[model samples]
Target chain A: MVEILYFAWVRERIGLPREQVETNAATVADLVEELRAREERYAAAFADLSALRVALDQDLADFDASLDGVREVAFFPPMTGG
Target chain B: MDIRVQSAPFDFGAEAGAFATGHDNAGAVVTFAGIVRDDTGSLQRMVIEHYPGMTERALEKIAREATGRWDLKDCLIIHRHGDLAVGEMIMMVATAARHRKAAFEAAEYLMDFLKSRAPFWKKEITGSGTGWVASKDEDEAALGRWSKE
Candidate 1:
């Protein structure tokens, strides 16, 4: 099981903040595809992959990054800090 | 080095004075503060969201990088998350070094990294509506200036 978190509009679109999903996906992209297939809300939240950024275990990572042994995944739009 | 991520507001003058006094041996101290801007005059409040664990880690990494790249005597970063009224301070960064050039450059470097690299998102709530603040391309471009140096 991997914990998934969504922030900003992604969270609003998905209607929640975090969840635990049981998956055997090879990478972040594969996991995204799995979530997108589960519901329309997920599809809408992830419709534009280009607008999103991914993090694995609290570190910024690419979508193609391997999820092996990873425990947490976060999906959000580009940061607008400072 | 000091990094703080909190929902409570901070006193910038006090913090700046404390930072400067704490690093009295340093020849220069530079500080920058960002306030919630209501450019349209319709903005009611700004909401900042952050990934808790990652936010602190990312900030620490940026501060560490700045210290490593410059001859810094001390560095401080304080960022607030949660709802904030217009004109309220959103964040502040301070850097101290042996020279004015290093202090100024390090502070700028910290701002550049914090603007995009940190895991914080801003939502502006105005009289008309609430929307996520889009990341500007110019801000991304600003980062390029540091890479070659």
Candidate 2:
């Protein structure tokens, strides 16, 4: 099972902060596609991929990156941290 | 080494001094603090929200990346959450290095990555209503410049 985490507006939109899901997806994009198909809330949260950012196991990464052996995935808005 | 994400206010001077302690090889310590401004114009207050687990991890990753990129002795990052008033300290970053160049560069690098990579969101609460602050494309572009160098 892979742990999926959400943050900020992404969490607000998805209505949850974290979840553990079993998936057969091999890449971040595939996982996102599966998530988008789950429910309207998921679709709405991930509607515009351009406005979002993804990280795998705490490291910044792209959507197309492979998720093999990845234990965690986090979705968040373009950061406004500093 | 100190990382705090709290609703309470912080003492910038105290934090900076603490990070600079016992570092004889460090010739310079650079610190940067971000303060909430009344410049939002219509907003009376701003609410800063973040994902607890993911936020901390993201910050640590950024800190680690900065440390790897620069020759630094230590670094500290503190960010406050919840409602904040104008002029209150929002965040602070401190970096210590053997020279001013690494210290300054690392501090700036930390801020830049924080601005574009950390998962914190801000909302403006005005007399009229509340609205999510739009992420600026310029901020992303600014961060992009760093990757090229």
Candidate 3:
């Protein structure tokens, strides 16, 4: 099971901060595709691929990044920190 | 390098004064502080969220990078999360180096990276409603200057 975490507005839209997913997807994009098919909220939160940033196991990662052996993933909008 | 991520408010003057006092080897010291801005007077507070472990790791990594790139005597980064009222300090960066140029440049680099690469997100809450502060394109652009082309 891979842990999926959401943050900020994405969390607000998905109505969840984190979830566990049992998936056989090979990459972050594939996992996203699977989640998008689960419900309208997931689809809406991930509607625009350009607006989202993905991280695998707490490191910055691309959507096409391989998820082999990865135990955690996160999705969020661009950071506005300082 | 000293890095702090706290929800409690920090005393800016005391922190800055303390940071300046101990750098005997450093000829120049630079400090930068970011304040919650409420230009229209509508913002009640700004809530900042962060990925707990990653935030500290990211900050430390950035601090390490700055130390490597500059001849810095010391550096400090303090950022606050949770509810922050307008005029409150959000974060501060202090750098001490042998020369003014290195001190100034490293501090700017740290600020630029913290604004874009760090994992924190800010949301503005006002009487009208609440909304996330979108990342500025200029901030992303600011980081490009630090990268070697």
- Give the candidate number with the greatest lDDT: 1
Candidate 3 on A1-46: residue-level lDDT in tens?
A: 9999999999999999999999999999999999999999999999
Sorted by DockQ (best first), the order is 1, 3, 2
Q: What are the RMSD figures for all models against the true structure? A: 0.9, 2.6, 0.9
Q: What overall lDDT, based on C-alpha atoms, would model 3 receive against the true structure?
A: 0.94
For residues B1-149, what per-residue lDDT tens digits would candidate 3 score against the true structure? Answer: 99999999999999999999978899999999999999778999999999887889889989999998997899999999999999999999999999999999999999999998889999999989999999999999998889877
Can you write out model 1's per-residue Cα lDDT over B1-149, one digit (the tens) per residue? 99999999999999999999967679999999999998998999999999999999999999999998897999999999999999999999999999999999999999999999999999999988999999999888999999964
lDDT of each: 0.96, 0.86, 0.94
Q: 2 or 3: which has the higher TM-score?
A: 3
Provide the lDDT at B139 for model 1: 88
Q: Distance (Å) between predicted and true CA of A42, model 3?
A: 0.1
Tell the DockQ for candidate 3: 0.89
Docking class of 3: high
- Mark the regions of model 3 whose C-alpha exceeds 4 Å error after superposition: none
Interface RMSD, in order shown: 0.4, 1.8, 0.6
Worst 10 residues of 2 chain A by lDDT: A73-82
